[model samples]
Target: MFERFTKDARSAVVDAQQVARAAHSDQIDSRHLLVALAESEGLARTALADGGLDVTDVVARARASIEAGDALDHGALAAVGIDLDEVTRRTEATFGEGALARAGRVLRVRRKHIPFTPDAKKSLELALREAIRLGSKEINGGHLLLGLTRAESPGRRVLADAGADLERVRRHAEGASEAV
Candidate 1:
């Protein structure tokens, strides 16, 4: 599948890995891929610009505490009487400050390579499908953006939170892909 990716598409994937690593993420995910696409200097970026969006603002929105889901989960636990905050407080009192926070990550060896999360892999597969659907011989950054828009992933959520119309981006991507 990678063999069919244009240089811009491949670079977006590579840049996603770097984005994940720089953010201290254990694995690359769709949010990182979205960031890479926003930063790409080609069709993907042009499509975004066509929507009157700022590349920096879009990237910032994608990077904005992807832990939003974690916060939602925490709220759900609270509603269920789990009270994670209280749990953390008690655990910290029993052990020490920041004990629970530092439990698993500090002692383990940090990886030199971060693997793609399931959502990221799915997005890549969807990109290929988008390319095929557009009758494009090779996937490009616009196809990657279309892939990100096609699925329910962190990338899509970030775009919504940033006030981007996903359907508009999709149209733009498809147009750009057709042009390519």
Candidate 2:
């Protein structure tokens, strides 16, 4: 299936892996893919922009979400009346800056391989379907973006949070693809 991906689509997939690694994620999620799409220059990016979504803001929010999700024991300690901010500050003073975040990154890297999350996998599969439906010979970034909208995934959530209308974005992609 990947063999059918255009150069831009292939690059977006590689970019998604880098995004997942940078976020210290155990798997490549839909958010990572969305970030990749937003960063890329193509139909996907244009569609997002046309829908009134700012790519930079989307990337920042996605990163924040990843950091929040990856936080270790902050909520649990807070429940016990412990201030995680103070703990982190003291720990950083003793060990070094970003000690906790660094430790988490190390652990995440030690896994050697990060697989795609189920939602991400589904999005990729749907991308293929979208390409076929559009009568395209190869899958492109627009198809990938459309696939995210078709799936119930973090990518879609990010788009929604950024005030992008999925249907409008889809139409823009389709119209752009026809023009191409």
Best by lDDT: 2
The residue-level lDDT of candidate 1 at 130 comes to 93
- Cα error, residue 23 of model 2, in Å, equals 1.5
lDDT of 1 at 113: 69
Put down candidate 1 lDDT per residue, 1-180, tens digits, no spaces.
999999999999999988775665667889999899898688888888886678799898877755444322677887888988888899999989988656634432267667898899999999999999999999999999998889899888888877888788788888988987
Error of 2 at 6 (Å): 0.5
Query: Which candidate leads in TM-score?
Result: 2
Q: Give each prediction's root-mean-square deviation over alpha carbons.
A: 3.6, 1.9
TM-score of each candidate structure, all chains considered together: 0.78, 0.90
Off by over 4 Å in 2: 71-73, 80-83
Measured on C-alpha atoms, candidate 2 has an lDDT of 0.86
Clash-forming residue pairs, model 1: none
Give candidate 2's TM-score: 0.90
lDDT of 2 by residue, 32-146 (tens): 9999998889988988888777889888887777666764768888999999899889999999999977888889878877899899999999989988888898889988998
Show where candidate 1 strays beyond 4 Å: 67-109
Worst 10 residues of 2 by lDDT: 64-73
